[model samples]
Structure formats: C-alpha cells, structure tokens
Target: MTTSFAQVMIFLGLGIGIIILLTAVFRVHAFFALLIACFVVGLGVQMPVAAIINVTKQGFGHIMQSLGFIIVLGTTLGVVLEHTGSTKVMATYILKRIGEKHAPLAMSITGFIVGLPIFCDSGYIVLSGLNKSLCRRTGISVVIMSVSLATGLYSVHCLIPPHPGAASAATTIGVDFGRLILVGMAVAVPATLVGYGWARYAGRKFNNEEPGQAPVVDLSLPTPSVLLSFLPVIVPILLIGIKSFIGIDANKPVPDWAGLFMVVGDPVIALAIGIIMALLAVRSWKKSTVSNLLQEAVEKAGGILVIIGAGGAFGAILAATQVGQHVSKVVNLQALGIFFPFLLTAVLKTAQGSSTVAIITAASIVQPLLPALGLDSEMGKLLAVLSMGGGSMMLSHANDAYFWVIARFSGLDMRPMLQVYTVASLFMGLITLLMVFILSLFLL
Candidate 1:
C-alpha cells in the first residue's frame, strides 16, 4: 500500500493532467472529470480494482453524508431570498444607508454578508440589477461595483462555512467548522477590503465614462423587512459561533440551555432552521411558489453535490495512494509551513477553475501530511483549511464560471474584465494568504 516518492509524483502529475485534459481541454463536466481523475489515481497507485470501487463509493458517500444537508439547506435559503426579493431589499437598504460615494464598499459588504448563505454566482445574479442601479445613481462605473461585488462574493464563498467549498474543505481536513468560520471571517475581512480598494481604483481608471440610464427591474414585489431578511444568515452564524465558544464535548457536563443550543447550533440543523426562516420571510408563501423554489434549489444543489462528492472520491484515492506520506518524506513542507497547502490549491484552482475542487483535493493531499508539516493541532488544521481557501481565490480567469458571470452580467469587455476582476482576484488571494500566515504566527 506504500507508494514510492517517484510513484507519488507520477500519480500526482497523471491525476492533475487528467483533470486538466478532461475538464479544460475536452470540456468534460467537472463532476465526471473529477470522478475520472479519482479512478485514474486509484489505478495508477496500484490499488486493487475492487478496492478502487469501494474507495470511490466510500469517499463519495462520506462527503455527501457530511455535506449533503448543509449544501441543500444553504441553497434553499438562498433560493428563497432571491425569489422573494429579500436579497434586493438588503442590497437596496445598504446602498441607501452608505450613499453614493461609498457604493463600492457598500456592495462589497452586501456581497460578503449575502454570500454566507448564497453561492457566488446566484448572489451576483440576484444583486446585479441592484449594482446597475447603484452605478446609475452614483455615476460610478459598473466595472468598480461589479468587481467589488464579485470580490465580496468570492471572499466568503471560498472561506466561509456553509458555502460548500469551505465547508467541504473543513470536513475533509477534519477541522472544527465553527473555528474555521471564525478564522475565515478574520481572513475574509481584510481580503474583502483589498478587493474593495482594487475596485475603487479600477472604477476610476478603466470606467470613468458617464453613467447611462439604469436598466428597469420589477420594483412591485413586496420585499421582506430588513431584520427578517437578515435572520436566516445571521442566526445560524451566531448559533454556530456560540457552540464553538461553549466547546461541545461528551466529557463535559452540559446544562439544559446549553443542550438546546447544542442541537440548534449544529451546522446542519442551524442551516435547516435558516431555511425555514427564509421560507417564512417570503412575502407570499404559496405552496406552489414554495414548491417551485425548492425544485430550483434542488436542481442547482444537485450539480454541486456531485462535483463535491467526486472531489472527495479523488481525495480519498490520493490518500489511498499514500501520496501525502511520500511527499512528506521527499519535501520539508514544515519549512514552507502554511504556504504549501495554499500553493497546492492555487495550482489546482488556476488549472481546473473550480475553487471547491481545489479545496477538496488540496485538503485531501494535506490531511495526511499535517503532522509532518507541524499543522496537526486544531489551530494548525484550521489554518490549513483557511490556507487552501486563500489559494482557491487565485487567478479567476476565462475558465472560471464566475468569471463569465461577472463578464456577461457586468458588461465588461474581455480586456477590462482581466484587468479588474481577474487581477483583483490575484491580489485578494495573496493578501488573504499573507493575512493567514500572520495570524498563524500568533494563533498556532
């Protein structure tokens, strides 16, 4: 079951090559591509054929078991917010309070908070109309607002839990979810600020054109109250954070009130509660409307679920190959510290254009090396999780779906899109990694 260092390198190369060829060159769907990569790695590492099947099945099942309810509930909450105009209400409220001069910052904050529950793509689509409105009103370039919004969404999507990428990475690496959330928030704030800075500069330089008439959007829907709109996201975060504070353990005696928080504070249950709150926040809660929204959410969740499961399978195969142990013997990753995970994930992300896949695979690769790398403590593992997230933020270019979403929705030409959003992603990711490194010195 042991792999030689040379065999590990070859397996790594073959695995990554298959992923790039299938997903990048042939345009195979990422789910199938990751599954294929898993099988290839399993075979290349000399796993028995029957064991490969069992490993793949177990890996896929394990990830889905950990992530299925969280992803589904999170997406459903987002769907309700988007379909019911709650997202818009929050966006509009933030813009009005911040006024025109600070619209980019406002949008950044909106994207950060909203992104906790919604996927970045859906969050961008939900808020694009609002972004357009802000541009027209403030005479700020759509480029700045778009980049700011994208940066904000990207920040939380990669780092924050219940966002699938972060959640799966945390789960895969066996980090505490609540601690990851806290650390992710710590890193996200500065990274988002870096993105906001880039957005402001890009707005002034590349998009100084006079604003045109804003596109017309339906304003007749009854929006949820601001407090009600925020409850879904805010409550779960608070509950989970509280649980982290109390330190749930069987060894410790639990009070009754603490027991209640423990049940509600579990990530799955908290998100499920958020889903119900989101459903209630909808202005008209007709059964048909609810049914349709659930269907749409499920459809979106299905694609993400498969990709995550496949990524898990891929990681499982890597572990089976004992690549981590081989790499540990060959490389002094302890010297590189947190940067090792970040660099590995950045390469995967830049190559394959999926942050979730990058995080999952990187975590799998790093999990077994934790002791060798001196990242075996809870704090160290949390840092590793955040490091992978930081890496996933790098180089969001043409191959990235989010790149196209910002391009098409924001009406940015290819050149400016590269300059603004793409370059900004690089900056944000680097700044985040730097921040994570600095924090690790103190915490780890």
Candidate 2:
C-alpha cells in the first residue's frame, strides 16, 4: 500500500508526536513510547493492522539480532579503558601536545577524533571524567573541559557514518558509506572549529576558577598494546568504506581478508573482537586467570546494553508505524526537504532527550519518500543523521546526562554549566548545520 504525503503527515505527526509527548510527560522509556505510537498509528491508518502488529516484533527482533552483542562489547571495552587509565594516558598525550595555551583546542580535536569510532556516551564516560581531573589541576572549571569534550564527541558521532547511529540511518536510506564519510568530513571540520571556539571563549570567561588538576595518571595501570587498542575500531571502518566505494560484486569472489572484514564490520562482531582482544591485550589469561578485567567489561556494558536495546525497540516501532513517512510528506508538500530531516529530528531530540531515537525515527520516515521526491537517499539519510546530532547538541540542560556529569565533575553550579556546556553545543551544532547545508548543495 502506497502512503500519500498528506495521509502520511497526519499519521506521522499523530504517532511521533504522541511518542515525544509520552516520553516527556510520563518519562516512559522511549522504546515503550515508540511501540505505543506504532500501534496507535497503524490502527488509525488501517494498515494491515494485524500484520503490522506482528511486523513490530520482527522489526525489534531484527535490531536485537544485529546489535545486541556489539553494545555489550563496546560497554566492556569502555569500562576497562576507563579503569585502566588509558583514557588518562591518551589525554596526557593530547594535553602535552596542545599545552595549556591551547588545551581546549587540543581536547576538541582529540574528542572529535576519538568519537569517530566510539559512541558519544562512551566518549563522555571516558573524556568527561578525564577532563574533570584536568580541570582541577589547571584551575579550569569542569564545565569548560566537559563542553570541549562533549562538543568534540558530538561532531564525529553525529556527522560520521558507521558509528552505529549513522550506520543504521545509512542502511535505512540505502546510502553509500563512502559518500557519508566524504561528505561527513566536510561538515565535521567546521563543526569542530565552531565547537572549539565556543569552548575556548567560555573556558576563558569562567577563568578556570575550579583550577587545573589532571590527576596524575598512574602509569602502573595495566595497559593494552597499541595495536590491539586500535584494531577493532580501525578494521571495520576500512572494510565498510572500501567495499562501498569500490563496488565489489558477485562476479568477483571477495578476497578472504575482505570476507573477514565483512564479518568484523558487523557492529556486534566488531565490538566483540575488541572485547576479546582487550582480554588478550591486558595479558590476563597468559599471566593467569581472566576474572577481573573480563568481569569489569561485562559490568560496564550492562547499562549501555539496556539503553541501546530500548533505543532499538523505539526506532523499530517508529518505522513499523509509518509515522515517519507521513511526516516527511507533510515536509515535502511544503518543499522543506532540506530542513525537514533536521527540523523533524530536532523536535524529537528536544522533546524526548534521546538523539538515537530522533535520528532513527527521522531516517525511517524519510526513507520511504526518497524515490517519490526524486531525492538522493544518501542526502536524506546523512542529513537526518547529522540533524539529530545537531539537535542533541543544542541544549545540554538538566535533561541531558552530560549536564550533571559536567556539573558534578567541575563542581560548578547549574547557571555556569549552561554558559559553557549548553551554549558551546549550540554554537558547534549551528556551525555543523551550516557546513552540512553548503555541502548538501554541492554533494546531494
């Protein structure tokens, strides 16, 4: 059954709006809100109501099948890295290079680079914690440092594809991975700079009242090998991009290594590789038993896994309900294609406080409309991904996890945290939008 623009809009708004409203009001998990929205919209639209209901199960199951293991693995590695002080070492290396004179810029770059492969929440768990320690030493407020780190992470996580969120968006819209990376970089650099400017200016205004005090990283911590440290993250990225750009086909057998790449490129597989490799890298088994590090990894991954799974459920329902399609049509009728992706996703992010759901919902809705509008799927997908990133960065207030983390770390009051973290996110996101808009004109 074909979904027309107006009908799509009515259902889409009703469905997505209800989810957003419920998320805000009831504080129900996004996953539940999305599922409810799906049921409501599907029934209202009279879309194979029974079948659509069944499809919801498949949709959520598909996400779990694809991503369950990966989130766990990522969580484990993140926890171990934090406990091991690898984060501190990396920060130490970066801070030394940038020096106190431009540590903020350095943090921004480091955060951006690290965030490309890692999720923003994970990055914050590591970077924000480290940044706060640095703040105490340098007399810099935790607020300034946290914003710098968050800004950096936000740019890469949002703009770059293949970090689960963008990868999901890309698949939904049939976008080429290479195009996302190429075009993403074009937008990312400017976003980084703008975020940097905001962080630095705000940092200076706060005047490091908290004092600079990067806790001396205890080097005795059990660190992993450099190769193992970077392998899983680097390897999968290479595979997806090369395969996408080169157009490897059925006629030619995939090289053995390429097949391995494909296996590892699976989000679940890639992160699992990292988890297993981390065990070896720490030399836990070779030295003796592997209890401490292994257990730590599992523990760390628990919260992240629940949240990710819930996010997946939410996204699945959004697609199943077809509200996204409806909303995109309303957008099309207004000739608002370029901004529709951004505006729609931003509303979700602002109202619901879950960027993952915002990106996923927008991409799913926008996906069904690409051909009808004669639009490039890549354009719509990439825009939707970045738009969610932008909106998520728009306000780092109490609703945001980063808000409390930054406030607690820096020992700053709510008012000042807003000045540094909240405003910096807005500035950087705006710059990112500008870059995306300009590039979309040429690349799309």
Candidate 3:
C-alpha cells in the first residue's frame, strides 16, 4: 500500500504530461483532458476504481460549490459593463484626464482598472479602439500602446480573484478571498508598471508601425458617468477589504456595525451587490435585453466553470496519492518554497498557453504539497496563489489566444509581437514572482 516518492512523482509526471499532451498538442477539450488525467493518476497510484470515480465527482462539485456562483456573478457584472459602454466611459475618462502626451500610461491604467471586472481578451477587444485612437492622435508607436494596454490587463487577470485562475487557486488552497484580492492587487501594481515600462522602452526598438484605424465609437448611446462607472468595481473591493481587516485581529473586540459589513463583504454577496450596481448603468430595462445579457454572462462563465471543476478533480486525485507527504519526506521542497509553484506554473502556461488552466492545474498540484513545502500557513498559501499567477503570465506566444488578440487588434506582426509583448510577459512574470518571493520572506 506504500507508494514510494519516485513512484508518486512518476505518476504525477505522467498525469500532468497527459494533460499537456492532450490539451496543448491534440487540442482536446480541457474538461475531458483533466478527467482523463485524474483517471491516469488514480490508476497509477493503485487507487480503487470506485474511489477514483467518487473523488472526481466530489472534487468537481466542491469547486463548483465554492466558485460557481461567484464566477457567474462576476461574469454578469462584466457583461453589464461591456453592454452599457461603461468600460469605454471609464477608458475615455482616464484618457482625457491624463492627456495624449501620456497616452500609453493612461491606457495602461485604464486596462488595469477595467480588467479587474472582465477577461483580458474581451477587455482588449473592447478598448482596442481607444488604444488605436490614442496611438494615432499622440503619434505613439502602436507597439507601445498595444503592449501597455495588453500588459496592464494581463497583470491583473492572472493574479486577481473573480478572474477564475486566482479564484480557483484560492478555493483549492483555502485562502481568504478578501485577503487574496488585496494582496493580488498589491502585486499587480508593480507587474503592471513593469509591463508599461518595458513597452515604452522595447516598443521603440521595433519599427514604429502606424496603428490601424480606430474603431468608430457610437456617440448616441448614453453612458454611465465616470464616478458611477467606478462604483461597481470599487464597492465590492472596499467591503471585502474592510471585512478582511476586521478578521485579521481576532483578539480585538468586534464592533456592532461590523456585522453588516461581514454579510455584504462575503465574496458572493459582494459580487452580487456589484451586479446590482452594474444593472443601474443599463439604459434599457426591457425584459429581453436584460435576459439576453444575463444569458451572455452565464454562457461566458460556463466553460470556465467546467474547466475549473475538472482541475479540482485532477487535484483531488493527485492529493489522494499522498504525493505531498512522500515528496516532503524525500526532498527539501520547503527550501524551494514559493519558487516551486512559480516554475511549475510557468512551465504549464508556456506549454498549454491558457493562464486559467495553468494556474488551476498548478494550484491543484501544489495544494497537496503545501504542508510539506512549509507553505501551509495562511500567508504562505496566499503567496503561493500569487506565485502561480506570476507563472501564468510568462512567455505568451502563438499558443496563447490573448497573444493573438493583442497581435490582430494592434496589427502587429509575429516577430514584433514576440519581441515586444511576449518578452514583456516574461519580464512581468519575473517581476511578479520576485515580488511574491519578497513578500514570502516578510509575511510567511
């Protein structure tokens, strides 16, 4: 019944390899791929067939229970923002305040803030016009404009919750969502800057290709005010942060008013409140329009939800093998600490090119290893979640859909895209990892 460390590692490698080969090479759907991986690892570890089946179902359901509604609520909020033109309103407002001279910086900031509520691909598409218009008007290189915006969005997408990767990781590792969000935002700020800085510097080295024509903005539609544009995003974060802070000092006497914040600040309730705020910006209250929009958000979240569930199943099987205990006894992974997750995730991200898959898979693998690696502490787990996020952003190339999104949207060719944005992603990932490592030293 005792599986050696080498055997555990071999089975683990085979399971992960199966995932990469099927997903990256054969182009199999991730949900099926992950399910197959769970079976492979389960069989390799000599687990009972019935146990494996039950574990898979349990793992999948657990992830769904934790993240399903939050993901849908967050996705719905994003859909509302997109349909109501609130994203553009926020982007335009920033562009005007920052002016054309600092257009790249303005675009980066816009992407960072807007990206909090939406996926990176959609965020880029929605704002690509503004990026192009800024480039044309300011005569900034399209390379700089595109990378700045892309990196800014990329920065937050990898690390933050309600964004799938980080959210799933938090659920797997049992970290506080509020703390993860606050810490994730802290790490994201520097990563965003590194992307911005790299874009401005390396973007000039490439030929300053003229950006494509800006997309026509629909001027007739009434948009949300800038202040109103910010509320939905900011309010949930504040509520979550306040609740987290109160809980941090459990010894302190709790306040009477804190009870209300606790309810509103729960991640699910917070995001639901956000959805209500997002609805306020909707110009049309028609039953059809609202129904269609909600449907769209659900549709968007559906694929993500399943993939995350599969990832959870995979991790459960991996954990069932007692691999973490074996590895902990055999090696000094504790010394490696945060870097283990960072490297594993970077490899997965580079291999498969889906940050969500990369982070979710990596977190599943790492979750079992946490106690052995001396990362079972609360802060250690938070940094681990972040470190996986750091890895998920590196080396975006042809395999990455987001890379192509930036490529086609900015009209940048492959060579330039690799040189500018791809390289920037590597730098961004490194800087983010380094930041996480330093935080581990202090906090862990």
Candidate 4:
C-alpha cells in the first residue's frame, strides 16, 4: 500500500506513541510490546497479517545478522568479568587511584571506556555492583553509584562504533567508524560532565539517607586481584582500537591463530582469556568453581538473548511503518524549512524510545538531504552525525528500557527516576548538541 505523507504521519505517530506507552507505563517487555504494536500498525494500515509476521521476522533477522554475535560475546564476557570479580578489581583500583570522593567520576570514566565493546545493560549491572560496594564502604548514595555506572556505560555505547546502536547508526548514516568515534569522543566529554553533575547532585539529595539501612553491597562476594579483572575489559577494547587505528580496514585482522582469537573472539572469549590469565596470576586464592561459574554465565546470557531479540523485533515494526520516508519528506526544505539534525534525532528518540532505532531512523531520513541541506559538506556531515547520535540521548523514560532498568535497580520511584535518569539523559544530549553546534561554528 502506498502510504500518503499525511497518512504515514498519522499512523507512525500512533504506532510510535503506543509502543512508547506500552513499554513504559504498562511495564510490558519492549520486545513483545513492540511486536504486537508492529502487528497493529501493519493491520491498521491495511496490510495483510501474513506480511506483518514475515516482515517482523525479517526485521529480527536483519538485526541479528549483524549484532547477534556481538551481543552474545559482550554479555557473556561481562558476566565472566563480573562473576570472576574482574570488574570489581578495576573499579576498586580506579577508586583507589582517584579516591571515593571522586567515585562517580571514576565510574563515569569506566562506563565511557567499557561502553564501546560491552552492551549497556551488561555493563550497567557489572559496574553498578562495584559502585555500590565503594559507596557503601565510603558512605555514598546509590545515585552516585548508579549515575556513575550509567554515565560510564552509556558514554562509549552511544558514541563509539562497534556498540550495536552506534554501529547501526554509523552504517545507516554512511559515517566512517574511525571518523565517527573521533567526532563522538569530542562530544562525549561534555555529555559525560553533564551527566556527572546530575549524578553528583542527585547523590547528595537521594543516597537513601535514612538513619539506618542494610548495606547494598554483598560482603560475601570474594574480591579478585585488581590486575586480573582489568585484563578482560582492557584487552578486547585494545584489540578493537588497534584494528580501528593501525589497521583501519587493511583487513589485517587480529590473528586468529593467536590463541584461537578471531575478530569474533567476543567479550566472552576475551574475558575468559583474561580470566584464565588472572587465575594464573594468583595461582592459589580462587573462590568459584568452574562448573558453577559457567552455569551462572549461561543463565545470565539467557536474559540478554531475549531482551535483545525483542528489541530487534520492535525495530522491524518501526521499519514496516515506513516512518522514514514520511519523516524524510516532512523534514525537507520545501516543508519544514530545513531545521537542525540534532533536534530531529532528539525528537525521534523522545517519541520512539529506542536510541539505536531512533538514530538509525533519523540518519536514514536525514542522509538523502546531505547534498540538499549542504550536509554533504564536511562540517554539515559532522553536524548530522553528532545530531543523530546526541538526539538519541533525549527524553529517556518508561518508553526506554534503560529508564526502567535504572528505575528497577536504583530503586527509585517513577517520578524521582524521571527526575534523575530521564533528566540526566536530556542533560547529556543537550550538552552534546551544544558542543557539536559550537564545533560547527568553528569548522563551518
């Protein structure tokens, strides 16, 4: 069916709104909620049900085709690092170096670094555990730990290539990975600082400061040698960075013969390699049995698989809505007078909730305009890249899975959660946008 511009707008808005509400308010799992929403839109638009199912599968298939292994490897590796106590060591070491007064800063920095290769969800869980320990020991609030963890994990995940959202957005928008990361980092520091301030203030206000409460840290958990824990997290990022910088598409892939390594050696394999080496480093003071450790990792991987697959399904439904074409037409020079790209991405992110989807959707709509909008020019391209990325950071709420996760783990009520996580996200996005605009002023 040829969806008219107006018709597409109406349906797309309804579809996007419903999916957001369903994901946020009713607390539906985003994957299933989005799946059902896709069905509704396809049917509402008068497409046959059969086509919807096929398209949904096709949507999932496409996401998994590129991202499936990365998600698996990343999550599994994060679990190993967390379970075997590698991340803990790194956090403590950072805390020691920087001091707990700067724990939020430390975690924020860590999140930025780890976010590149690790999935955000896994990174949050792993790093938050360590944050809580430091806070508990040092008399800090959960927000400090939570925000630090979030800032750290979200930084690289949103900005750098290789993370699914960034990678997907980059591929869709035609930005070079090496180049995007360079631009992303320039914007990321300001964003991180913005989130850090939000977290610090929130920490002071709401560190759960009752007269007395049970500690958040589970003291029974054995601490691994900090050196050992550092390796797994560090190695994969180093390898990927090396490939990106020194190799830069020479196809001189990290040698597969190097201990069964492949570009796909994944976070799991990477962490495992690090874990075994860490084990060797100590040789005596071990806590977990191999059987139990592997079992826990597998259990953790199950949730990662489900949530990720569901997100893929939701993305497909949006694609089916053909919102991209409608958005492209509506935002054109003849129509909306060629407004800013940052605003475009922010609106999509707020309206739609999935940053990856928002960025990719916005980029696709914005790409064809590169030439017409002068976006084909170097500064214009940079503006477009940062705008799409920064926009995806806006208005994170119940519509966003990250919002819910932060809400759940940080144990904040919805309103307060919004004040913190949602606002923090907006703060991050705005700072990124401003910096990009300033950069444009100079470059353009």
Candidate 5:
C-alpha cells in the first residue's frame, strides 16, 4: 500500500508529538518515550503488527550492536578521567597557559578536543568540576564556561567522525568516511567559534552567580601528568584520523602495517585502549577508590546506553515506514537547495532531542534524493552530511540529555539554561548552516 504524503506527515507528527509530550510534559523517561514513539509511528503508518515487533527488535539490536560497546568504553574512559583528576589537570594546564580571561575559550577548546572521543554528556560530567574550579579561581561566570564547553562538545559531536552521529550519517549516506572527517572538521571549527562568541556575549548579559560554595578539589592528591591526562582523549582521535587517511575498503588491498592502525583506530577499540590508559594513569590511587569509581561509571553509563538504544529503535521504525522515500517523491526538495537537508534535520532534532537520531534519520531521507538535489557528487555528499549535522544542533532544550548535563552540572536554573545553552545552540546551528551553505556553493 502506498502511503500518501499527508498520511506520512500525520504519522510523523504523531510520533514526534508523542515523544515530546511524554518526555517534556508528562515526565516520562526518554527510553520509554522513544520506544512508545516507535510503536506510535509504526501503527500510524499502518505497519503490520508482526512487522512492527520485528522492526523494533532489529532496530534496537542493530544500534546496540554497533554502538553499545563503544558508548560503554567511552563512558568508562570518561569516568576514569573524572575520578582520577585528569580532567582537572588538563583544565588547569590549559588555563594557566592561556590566562584566566580566556577561560571560556580554553574550556571551549578542551571540550572540542575531548568531545572527539567522548560523548558530550560524559565530557561535560568529566569537566564540570574543573569548570567550577576555573570559575572560582578566575571569577569567570560559570555560565560562560558551561555554554562554551557545551557548544564545543556539541559542535564536534554533531559534525565530526569517531562521534557515532557523524560517522553513522556518513555510512548511511554512502559518503567516504575520510572525506566526511575533513569536511566536518572544517565546518566544526567555525561552528565552535560561533558558539564561543555567543557564550562570551551571554556570559556578560546574564549574570546569575552560582548559588552554592564551590567543591574543594584536593590539591594534595597525586594527579597524573598533563601528557598522561591527554593520552586518553588524544590517542584515539589521532589513530582514528590516521585510519581515515589510510582509506580502508573491501575492494582494495590494505597493508599489514595499516591493519594495526585499523584495529586500534576503530572507535570501540580506541576508546577501550583509552580506558586502559586512563586506568594505568590513575593506578596509584587506593584499590577501593578505583573500584568505587569503576562502579560509579557503570551506573552512570546505564541511562545513556538505554536512551541510545531507544533512539536507534525509533530511527529504525521511521526507516521502516519509508517516509523519506515518500517525502522525496512528494517534495521538490532540490528547489530549496542546501537548506532542504538542514531544515529537515533541524525539525527532526528539535522534535526528538537526539542529534544522533536526527542525523541518521535525516541522512536516510536525503540519501534517496541526492541526485535530484545535486548532492550526488563526492564533495556534495560531504556537504549534505555536514548540513544535516548543522541542523542537528538546533534548539537543544529540555528533552536533550546534553542540555540537562549542561544545566545540572553547571548549576544553572531552568531560565538560565534556556537563555544561555539553548539559545546558544540555536545560534550555533544557524551559523553552521550558513557555513555549510557557503561551502555548498563552492563545492557544488
């Protein structure tokens, strides 16, 4: 049965509305809400009952299979760094060199680099304490540092590879992964700078001081060296970037030496290696302290893993409906040019509050229309991935986990969160879209 465009819109709207209602209004957990949304969309699209079940299972399993271990390893690495004071060491080193006046920029750069390997939530958690310390020491507004870091983390999280969102989008759209990396980096730097600019402006305008006393970091503890502190975050990015350069493909023969980099460069393995390095870097701590930290890391990772799985399931169900194919047939998306992908992804991200889901679903929708949209070329495909990524950054509000991570960790009230972090994301996303549009003009 052919689903009409209007019908598809209804199904899509119902699905997204239910998710927003459940998560934002009724206060349901995102995991349950996303699962419910999958069923709603499936049923609304009139998918068979049996098919819905299978699709849900396949979607959940596929996402978990691809990303579960990577997420866990990344979280473990984050936990190890957070507990071991490595995050603080790195923050302090950067601040000391740059001076306190540029604390926001320093934190932003730190977030940009660290977020390459770590999830934004985990990165924020790992650095929030250090953010507070920097704020206290420098009298810089915590709000400024918080938004700057959030923006930095988010810029790469949405744009760059080794981040599951961008990588997954690249794979889904059949773009060359290595090229996506280069394009994403080019886009991310400008997006991050836009974020930095907003954070600086917002920091001055909204002066809501942190309410409570800052947590005292122990100065006497034997912290890891700055170089050691960096290895967990840096090594994986370098290896992965190198692997992208090597260009592995099933059709071509790869060198034996390249094999080692491939093994180490896989996001899961690279982060796992990071975890091992993180553990070693903190080896001097008491055994019980280490044990507690590991346990805590596991506990924190549980919620995020569930949300990711649910998001995957939701995306799967959307794919099953073939809404993108239908939309491609109905809309003259080519007329809109580069803005088409960006607008579509922005709507998806704003509705669902998961950038990874937004990227995956948008890429799927855009893939079928690539030729029609003049995005069938190599460079065009990269731009499409980036345009979608830029859109994914729009309006990260109550529903986004990263939003809460920024709000809770940085101790901002709801009003401030909306004003600072949420608005900044919207601005940053627009800036990124502008950059993508300009790039498309040249590349296309």
Candidate 6:
C-alpha cells in the first residue's frame, strides 16, 4: 500500500490523461469516462477493489447529498423560466430600461442574472433569440451581441452556485455555498464587463454578419410581469445572501429569526422556494403540462447530476492516494498559491472541455493540499474555489458545447467565433482570476 510520490503522481497524471482521452478524443460520456478514470487511479495506486468501490460510492453519495436537491430545484426553476417565457420577459424588460443604444450591456446583464439559476448552454439558448433580434434592430454586429450574452452566462456558470460546477466545487472544497455565491457574483462582474468590452472590440474588428430573423416565439401564454419573472431568481439570492450575512460574525448572538434563515435561506430550501415562485409563471397548470415540464427539468438535471457525481468519485479515488501531501513536500505549490488551482482547472477545462468536470476534479486534487498551501482558512478555501471557477471559464473552443450554441445560434462561422468568442473567454477568465487574486490579498 505504500507508493512513491513519483509513482502516485504518475498514476494520477495517467488517470487524468485517460479522462481527457476518453472525453475529448474518444467522445465518451464524461460520467463513464470519469468512472473509468477512477478505477484506473484506484487500481494503479494499489487500493483494494472493494475499498475503491466503497470510496467511489461514498464520494458520489456525499456530493449528491450536499448538492443534488439544489441542482434539481435550480434546474426546475430554469426550465420553468425557459418554457414559460420568464427569461424573455426579463431580457425585454432590461432592454427597455437600458435602451437600444446600450443593447449589448443590457444583454450582458440579462445573461448574468438569468444564468445564475441555469447552466450556461441552456441560458444561452433561451436568450439567443433575443440576442439576434437586438442585433438586427440595433445594427450592432451579432458577434458583439452573442459574445456579450455568452460571456455573461459563462462567467456566472463557472462561478455561481446552483450551477453544477460551482456548487459541486463548493461542496468538495468545504466552502459555504451562500458565501461563494455572494463572492462569485461580485467577482463575476468584472469578468462580465471585460468580456463585454472584448465583444464590442471583436465585433468591430471581425464584422461578423447577423443571423437570420429571430425565431418567432410562441405567444400563446401570457408573458409573466417583469417582477414575477425576476422573483424566482432574486428571492433565492436574497435569502441566501441574508443567511451569509447573518453568519458572517459568528460571535454576534444568534438572533431569534436566525431559525427562519436556517430554514428558508439554506441553499436547497431557497431554491425550492424559487421553484414554487417559478410555478407562478405557468398560465395553465394542467397536470400533463406541469408533469412534462418537471420531467424535462429532471432529464436536464439528471445528466448534470451523474457527471458531477462521477467527478466526485474520481476525486475520491485520487484523494485516497494522498498525492497532494506528497506533491506538497516535493514542490512548493504553496508559493503559486491561488494560481495553482486556477491553472490546474484551466488545463483540465481546455483539455476535456467541461467546466464542471474541471472544477470538481481540481477541487478534489486540491483539497488535501489546502493546509500545505496555507489556504486552510475559511476565506482561503473560498478563494481557491473561486480560483477554480475563474480558471474553468477560459479557452472554451470548438469542443465546448456552449461555444457551438453561441456560434450556430448567432450565425457566426467557426473562424469568427474562434476569433471573438473564444478569445473573449480567455480575457474573461483572466479578469476573473485577477479579481480573485485581488480579493485574496485583502481577505486571505
């Protein structure tokens, strides 16, 4: 059972290489790929077969227990918003308030807010029509509009909770979910704006043509009012934020109302409240329509849940090797500090192309080394989680499904997308990392 640090490190690298090979090169499902990688790492590290299975199961179950309900509830809210036109209503409301001259900024803000409850790809799809319509009406290049929206969505998906990556990473790294959400939202702002700026410049330089007419939306259902449309997203954030603030100074005597915060402001409960509010968007709550929509949300969340669970399994197997302790003694990765997680996640993301997988794996790999890297403090761990989130945003390219979602939906050719959107992703991630770094100086 004893293995050299070099041996363990080699096996770890091999296991991750297999993940990238299966997922990226062979197009294997990440769940299966990650599971396979887990076994590879476990067996290579000389773990007993039964122990590997038990650890894998425990890891997967742990992640599901902590983060599963939140993901499902959040996905349900997103599905309800998408199907019921709440997403469009929010977009239109923002556009009206911001005016056509500020269309890209409006779209960026819309994507950021809407993306908080959903995956980036789904968020982009839900808003793509609005992006196209705005591009046509405002005479801004579609590239600008699409990149603006895509980057906004991308920034939050990588950082904010209720999105699988950030949630799972928070669970793995032992960071408070509410605090991560608050910090992530703040950090995401600069990244979103930087991405927006890059989009504007790239649009002018690339001059990509607009897509065809915006797809006609089904107008059968009454669009929800702007306040109702925003309620689901806003209420959950406020509840969670209040909980975080209440807990900030633990020495302060717990207030009598803290019990309520403990109940409604828990991330899972908050998301459940959001789902209940989202149900208001349904015009006719026929059992059949409601059932189907809930089913669709489950189907969407199912894929994400399994993938994140497998990532947890993969992390567990790696953790079992105690490679982090070994690596810490050999190399002063502590010196790299925050950049270590960021760079590691960036590599995993660029290689295998799933931000969720990248962040989860990086969190698993980094967890044991937290003490070694002088990041074992509460705030330090959060910055590490955010650092991984920042790294996961970079270098999205042809392999990323979200990239294609933006390109095809926005009518940008591959080269133009690579030039504008892909490049913008780099800057967005870097800017986010920069923000995290700055926060680290103050908080850490």
Backbone clashes in each candidate structure, one number apiece?
Answer: 0, 16, 0, 6, 0, 0
**How far is 100's C-alpha from truth in model 6 (Å)?**
0.6
CA-RMSD of model 4: 5.3
* Cα error of candidate 4 at position 226, Å: 3.6
TM-score of each: 0.96, 0.81, 0.97, 0.73, 0.85, 0.97
Query: What does candidate 4's lDDT look like per residue over 268-340, in tens digits?
Result: 3444555455445444443555556556766755554454454555556556666655656565542322246
- CA lDDT, candidate 3, residue 183: 93
- Where does the lowest 10-residue lDDT sum fall in candidate 4? 210-219
Point out the higher-scoring one by TM-score: 2 or 5.
Answer: 5
Please give, for residues 139-177, the per-residue lDDT of candidate 1 as tens digits. 788888889999999999999888878888888888878
**Superposing every Cα of model 2 onto the true structure, what RMSD results?**
4.1
User: CA RMSD for every model?
Assistant: 1.9, 4.1, 1.5, 5.3, 3.3, 1.3
Which structure among the candidates has the greatest TM-score? Answer: 6
Candidate 3 clash pair list = none
Clashes of 2: 16
Predicted candidate 5 versus true structure: per-residue lDDT over 39-98, tens digit per residue: 888888789888888988887787678767766776678777766778777777887888
Q: How would the candidate models be sorted by TM-score, starting from the highest?
A: 6, 3, 1, 5, 2, 4
Candidate 3 residue spans exceeding 4 A from truth: 213-221, 251-253
Cα displacement (angstroms), candidate 2, residue 204, comes to: 2.3
Report how far residue 248 has shifted in candidate 1, in Å: 5.9
Residue 328 accuracy (lDDT) in model 1: 80
lDDT by residue (1-444, candidate 6, tens digit) is 898998898889998899889988989999998999889889998999999999999999998998889889989989888878999999999999999999999999999999999778888887888888778788888888889999989999999998899899899989988899998999999999999999988788655486744455664567788899999999999999989888888778868979799789998889988988888766567788789889999999999999999988988887889988899889997799999999999999999888988898888898988988878999999999999999998789988888888877787888879988999999988998899899989998
lDDT of 2 by residue, 108-187 (tens): 77787667656676666666556765665676645566677777877777666545556556655666665676667667
lDDT of 4 at 188: 87
Estimate, for each residue in 189-257, the C-alpha lDDT of model 3 and write its tens digit.
999999999999998976569776445645344788887788898999999888898888768877897
Give me the displacement of residue 408 in model 1, in angstroms.
0.4
Model 1, global lDDT: 0.85
